[model samples]
Target chain A: MRVIFNEEMRAVADDLDTMAQDVRRAINLSCTALLKSDVEAAQSVIDGDSAIDNLESSILDQCVKLLAKQNPVATDLRVVVSTMRLASTFERMGDLARHLAEAARRTYPQSAITPDAMPLFTQMGDFLTVMADRMVSMLADRDAKTAEQIILSDDQLDALHHKTFDLVLADDWTGSRQDLINVVLLARFMERLGDHAVSAARRVVYIVSGFDPTKEPSRDEGTDID
Target chain B: MRVIFNEEMRAVADDLDTMAQDVRRAINLSCTALLKSDVEAAQSVIDGDSAIDNLESSILDQCVKLLAKQNPVATDLRVVVSTMRLASTFERMGDLARHLAEAARRTYPQSAITPDAMPLFTQMGDFLTVMADRMVSMLADRDAKTAEQIILSDDQLDALHHKTFDLVLADDWTGSRQDLINVVLLARFMERLGDHAVSAARRVVYIVSGFDPTKEPSRDEGTDID
Candidate 1:
């Protein structure tokens, strides 16, 4: 009985892990579609989102099924429930990536502004790519420290976002304001994607640490600064 | 054993239903604060949101605990999982409403647009308020028909959104373009709130029907009959 129970538990974990992998792939595919200006790839990501959603649903269903069937204890239950939430976050991440891809498709073949704007966007894209990779790694490792790091990384993304706005609104922008607005919206989407990833990373920290920052601490003590 | 089990299940359901009620109130409070320019009410909503988040986490914890201890199956699992997701949507609704409140506070006294422009903004507010109320009712009743009705109602919100843009870009507009732009962004937020509510309604329908519309039915299969 114990052997069978252990095997079933492993199966559920493996299923969730595989779903996470699929989410990572979907994010990469969406980003690649954006960078290469590939409409087909963009459409593929949009169309393929349904599959990712289905997978998320399936993983949650399985986790619930296991909990109902096995009556997993405290830690196990937390892990499963946390994964369920994590899966939803990953699904939203895929949606954000797809939105970016679509935006790229819409504004393709014509540069809205001078080539100077490209470098900042490229940097932002690089930041997102790193964030995505780190998010996946943190989820797999369940490393609370790494998860915390992801949240801090969002500050840098925020800086980039501010810079993006300044560049768009600068006097040198001779492009159509509407097109510039779309670019801002696209950058906003990417920034939000980073925020969601950070939020998810925070959730992972909560799962592993048994303390959610969303929960207020009972008491605050003053910290010493150098 | 059966008696004890049923009693525990009842307790869980009651807690979830109460939490949902609080969610409805929180969202309404935020919206009311926005429309009425009640800064105190808005602050109350903002301060109270932590309670909602806390409630959400504890409700989730309870769901996990119930699954581990009671091992609820079949419909019970669906009920818990559905409620969990619904709670999240409610939380986001509250967040969006809070944002609207902040926007109102930022644009206090509702700008000095002409009386004619005021009518259009009033109409936009009315449309959003009605949509929000309908959504609350749909969730409470779990009525798929009402959910579909609300989805159709979103088209009205979209129309109002366009009307807002038209009014802002009109030749008679003498106000600062930035103020009009701000109003446009606010209008967009209201439209998005409607979209989110409609989405929540759709999820309720899915929970009740166990139907995957994404897989089985074409979204526009019968819409062209008129």
Candidate 2:
């Protein structure tokens, strides 16, 4: 029974790694589509989101089965519960990628970010891509240090999000009302993506250190940036 | 042992009820703040969000303890897992309220919605407040019918959200760029509040019916609305 439980746990971990990879790919594809105005890439990201969603459900089912059959307790139980949460977080990250793609698709033949705001968005995309990759690694290794780094990197993403806001609201801004609306929503999608990544990292810290980092004051809460 | 487990489950349910009430109040207060430009109401919502968060943590701790001690299987297991998800959903609803309040506070002395857009937002707020109230009741009764109603109402919320987009992007829109940004973010926050409410409702449906409504096509997924 112990051997089977360990193997099943390994299988769950493998599934999570696969889900993380899919999310990373979705993020990268969506960012590329947004930056280059590639509708095909955007459409692909939109189409592929369901697979990520399916993976989350599969992971959840596995966790529920493990809890029912194995009766995992203490650290083992925490791992199962946290796995469910991590899967949900990754699923949401995939949705954010799809939202970015939708923005790109909606604005087809025209870039979502205006010329003046493109640099800020480009930086935001890069940060999110890196964050996604780090999250994948952190899940695999279960290293608290990597998780901490992902949390720190989210600060940079937040800064870029603020830059996008500033660019839209600046005195000399030349974007139309539609452009203003799109920029605000797009930046918010990217910022929320970063927030979910931070959340996933915190869960890792919780599972490893047995200290719930979520109990601490959440930096994203009640902030000026939604 | 069964009686003890039953009692503990009821405690979890009661805590969820409290959280839902807090979320409902937050929604009403934040909307009042936004529509009325009430800075103090906004501040109160912001200050009170931590209590909701604390309730969520408490509920999670309770659920985890139940899982470890009772070793609940089958329906009992689903109840515990679903309760955790529901608590997370309510916590997110509280955050959305705080976000709305922050929008109001940021634009204090002036309503977040421009005069022309006020009616639409007012209706949106009304729908969300009702949805929150129903969500609280649904959590208590675990009624699938009420859960379905919450899901349907979210469509109205989405329509209102799209209406806000149209209003902001219209050629006649005279609001400043800041106004446009605030309107978009605020509308998105409200729409997301509806979405979370729908999520909590679906979890209730899952618990009651043993048919995962989440497996069905997600209404919010891959849409033009971000």
Per-candidate interface DockQ score = 0.28, 0.66
What is candidate 1's lDDT per residue for A90-148, written digit by digit as tens?
Answer: 77776666666666566566443235567777777788778777877887778888888
What is chain B's TM-score across the candidates, in the order shown?
0.76, 0.96
Give me the displacement of residue A178 in model 1, in angstroms: 1.2
lDDT of 2 by residue, B1-226 (tens): 8899999999999999999999999999999999999999999999999899899888989998999999899999999999999999888888889989988898888788799989998999899878988998888899899999998777788888888888987888898887888788888888888888888888999999998755877735324555
Question: Per-residue lDDT tens digits of candidate 2, residues A1-226?
Answer: 7788899999999999999999999999999999999999999999999999999999999999999998898999999999999999888888889989998998999998788888888888888878888988999999899999987777677777778877877889998887887788888888888888888998999999999865877635224655
Model number with the top TM-score? 2
Q: What is candidate 1's CA lDDT for residue A215?
A: 60
The estimated TM-scores of all candidates read: 0.81, 0.97
| Reproduced native contacts, each prediction | 0.28, 0.61
Candidate 1 deviant stretches above 4 angstroms: A1-15, A18-22, A25-41, A111-117, A169-173, A213-226, B1-41, B109-121, B158-185, B212-226
Q: What is the TM-score of chain A alone in each candidate?
A: 0.84, 0.96
lDDT score, candidate 2: 0.87
The lDDT of each candidate is 0.64, 0.87
What's model 2's lDDT at A24?
95
RMSD of each: 5.7, 1.3
